[model samples]
Target: MFLYMLIYLAYHGSRWIPRKQRLKFQIVNAVVITLVLVPQFYVIGRSKSSRYCKQPLLNNLSASIAFSFIASGFSVIFTLIEPIPQSLWASYHLFGLLSCGEGLCTTILTLTAKDCVKTTPELYYMSLFQTVASILSTGFFMVRGGLWLTKLNPGTDLSGNNESPAVPH
Candidate 1:
């Protein structure tokens, strides 16, 4: 989402802009990231997220934290561009674009499969999971964004708001 774009500024920003500048891009990004992460960490503390995670808690915690960080990135983007533009930049489609961006890393790795598979066998398999997650996420976003999922069945938002997608008719 737009919240993710705050990071774009942070990473792709100019080397130095100033108090002499008006709404300096770097300062705005720094403030946005700081403000967004504050609430995220607070939520992590209050929620029993770790306790509910699967056993061998360590492994699951890692996944949970990673997801939280991802969400935080999205939230930062959202903060920057809230009252989201109503054109083709709707949530589902934007997330689809983000998901495709996520896949790029694995895509590059995939292109060099033999080297990784031989060099670090476990990582090769692990990257497959990342690739699949990226594809499925993108598919979900696209389906909803393109209205295909809604067209398939009315009153189904896929977020459990209306009749469940699995509900018996």
Candidate 2:
């Protein structure tokens, strides 16, 4: 639990780094994400670890889903905290990146740990489900925010065709 919190902090804290230092933050973000993913995969992959865990497989998967939702919430919180106007864009991008990273980490770990899952179709569906859910949730919030902005400033272009608003302090 402590390790997970540290990884979360590393990823979340990176947002506070100045723009000039963003590259460093990105690197740190990547490393920390990798660290968190390792344990996540270990818990999910079929093995003694999964079997010995207190909860059943369904419960474990549910917990994983909940974790992603919480991560999404954090992404939103971090975006709101950002001083820049384009923070939503950054947040969504980061959320997507984190989703993909976690999915890949789990998939690779599953395959490497065992050959029990034989069907590629099952994996495909699972991946699709995760991808769709992550995108829908993130996009929903982003669009909602945009709609609010448009409602607030009628003169500003509200159409989806309009270019993204410039970042202002």
lDDT of 2 by residue, 3-112 (tens): 22333454457656675666666565556546545545544563443333222332435455556555545533443454545765465556556555554444444434
lDDT per residue (tens digit) for residues 45-128 in model 1: 443423332122223223434543665554444434434466624653465355455466455555556454544444444455
What do the candidate models score in CA lDDT, each in turn?
A: 0.47, 0.48
Give the lowest summed-lDDT range of ten residues in model 2: 49-58
Which is the leading candidate under TM-score?
Answer: 1
* TM-score of each prediction: 0.35, 0.34
Global CA lDDT of candidate 2, please? 0.48
Model 2 alpha-carbon drift over 4 Å, by segment: 1-12, 49-54, 65-81, 84-169
- Deviation in Å, model 2, residue 81 alpha carbon: 7.9
User: What C-alpha lDDT, on a 0 to 100 scale, does residue 6 get in candidate 2?
Assistant: 38
Clash number for every model?
Answer: 5, 0
Model 1 Cα RMSD, 1 decimal: 15.4
* TM-score, prediction 1: 0.35
